[model samples]
Target: MAGTDHSVAPIARGPSIVLVEPQLGENIGMVARAMANFGLADLRLVNPRDGWPSDKARAAASRADHVIDAVRLFDTVEAAVADLTYVLATTARPRDSFKPVRGPDEAGQELRSRIEAGQAGGILFGRERFGLSNEEVGLADEIVTFPVDPAFASLNIAQAVLLMSYEWMKSGRGENSRPRFVAPEVAPASKDDLHRLFHHLEDTLDEVGYFYPPEKREVMVANLRTMLTKAGFAEPEVRTLRGVLKSIDRALGEHRS
Candidate 1:
């Protein structure tokens, strides 16, 4: 085992924390404290209610004043992340939308990898009141979700930010090790990549006349897309699916002969 730093672990490439339309000053200050605790330096505030350079926020920040001082104000979430290549939105409820849902640990790994790969990355934390609008969330490249009791999943904004920061810091230090789980990096397929595969599958289905009754095609295709999307296919797994499609095509050709 390697010796790990028990102190606030700094990520080799830290992610910018963006608070979009946040409501409370105290929460902002606490978020700064949390970010500083885990060595996340960049903070962007979009349309804050209590305004910036707040004394209450500074007081809550305590020794984390550096984070507060480094905070940048933006008019919009898109403006805040205009230069970022990878953007992740933190949310509590899972939606039936088309996007990848990553736990904080996985999100941290992805963030670090992107940063190391010379990509600008950021994560959006929505307003304390309503959370991010579906439109606001649509701007993100991925979604980072925390695992909480299904019965009660509402987490304080600062708490959510802190938890993610903790996981990210731990991930950077290689502390998020589980003995039984498979490492996703070995030919792992990202959710976005997997989405492409699902689309391809549906397209192939159309070509082979799998869908009938033009009126029912939409519903059937949607159901099929959802089924495969939730199965969590990897890169190799998607490749295998393509292989299966190819084999089916060959058999169909032989039968036609």
Candidate 2:
């Protein structure tokens, strides 16, 4: 296993590769091949155009049958990442949105930290045609934009996956801390824990007037939830955060009075 998930012993923490609204089966297959090449195993599809489990994709995947076979399907991005604690959205072009952006190396370090804190962390890849929507990008805890020549920056889906996967795998093999074969002690956060923390944080944010438009509240909430969950905060850490929020609220109230 390239990445280890202490949550599920003998189970690796190869970040889930989510292809949101992918258009072509061949791309999906190729992405799978890339993942397999880098020791990633989980493949998730959200509203793919060409359809999943397609023989065309399998054929393209070549020796990556394990990735193709384990492909999980979902109708929406939210559903696809419901179980993930930390998520990074990959994009060649910046969205100009006000969210934390990281490169593959920093994102990989963050992912490893989150997993060590015992949370399920993963990355999201958008379609070849449109990349990720602002809405989709917002769902990520951290946005990843690869650095390339200013003239030519676009990367094929498989290339993006390979880059991120490679970084994560490299980080996992800390030379001084643990041997390559020896498993690390970290365990990723569970789906249920992430869901609860997201709700708690959203409620706190709502109370603080962070989300303004009532109409867009749901989407905003969903995006925030996605980002935090993907960061994969540990249960104790989440509890501490909630406490911090409560303290801040109390201080604000006191000042207003």
Candidate 3:
């Protein structure tokens, strides 16, 4: 709700989110909110219980109007996904049918691959109370299930949508798979820079008589070098550390004088 950036364009095409006989308008709105969060906009409703154009849904969406504005209404599950090339049904229980069952991550990758190949795809969500009947599950090509505790595995429609949406985004390739923001770029310290740091630090330690027993000095310095190398410090970090060592060296010199 808080991160919706109106300036950024929403993803016009991905997988169709087909909700079969959704009971509440708020849940519909929440579903839209989830879709928008992950750049999904196509929302298809198969006989929403409280009817369409719901103000409650709009309020619940928290300004994800792009998804709500282009909502498509269908009379049946078959009709809703009729145009799509592939469909995955969300269910918690095992079905008697022979459809290939996939977890959310695999389902997301499959959907992303299909969509990238210019195929239409969709996911079916059933009624909030009982979920998809076997008849409804039969409509989808594959079955996607969440790995939840068996004692209480039922998930809210919005939560189910969110999980799939997140996976869908993650399954993308290159820049599409990455999150909107990342850490600032910093140049890595070169091997020369690191070698310089190692010598500087070792020199300071030698001046301070830190390495006792001349035979163990080599092993101690090697261990210190190994520890510092593992950090993979950036150029700025290396410079800062060098400055710290210089300060210590100056302090030592003043004390000796």
Number of the top candidate by lDDT? 3
| Model 1: per-residue Cα lDDT over 97-213, one tens digit each | 677889998998888777765667789998887788765666677788888898988898899889878876776674545469644443444445545565677777887888888
TM-score of each: 0.65, 0.70, 0.67
**Where is model 2 poorest over a 10-residue stretch in terms of lDDT?**
2-11
TM-score comparison, 1 vs 3, better candidate = 3
Scored by CA lDDT, what does every candidate get? 0.77, 0.77, 0.85
What are the runs in model 3 whose C-alpha is more than 4 Å off? Answer: 173-257
Top candidate on TM-score is 2
Clash pairs, model 1 backbone: none
How high a TM-score does candidate 1 get? Answer: 0.65
**lDDT string, candidate 2, 1-257, tens digits:** 35533344223556888999888888888898888767788889999997767988999887577789889999988788878867788988867566788988989888887777666777899889779887777667779888889798888898899898888778777553544575554444554555556667777777778898888897787667655745646567766777887787788789889
- Kindly list the per-residue Cα lDDT of model 3 for residues 1-257, writing each as its tens digit: 26546898997689989999999999999999999999899999988889989999999998999899999998877678756656799999998766789999999999997787666788999899999987567656688999999999989999999999999999985654646886665565654566678889999999988999889986687667645755656679999999999999999989989
Question: Candidate 1 at residue 223, lDDT?
Answer: 61
Q: Score candidate 1 by lDDT.
A: 0.77
Deviation of model 1 at 54, angstroms:
0.4
Candidate 2: list runs displaced more than 4 Å. Answer: 1-11, 177-257
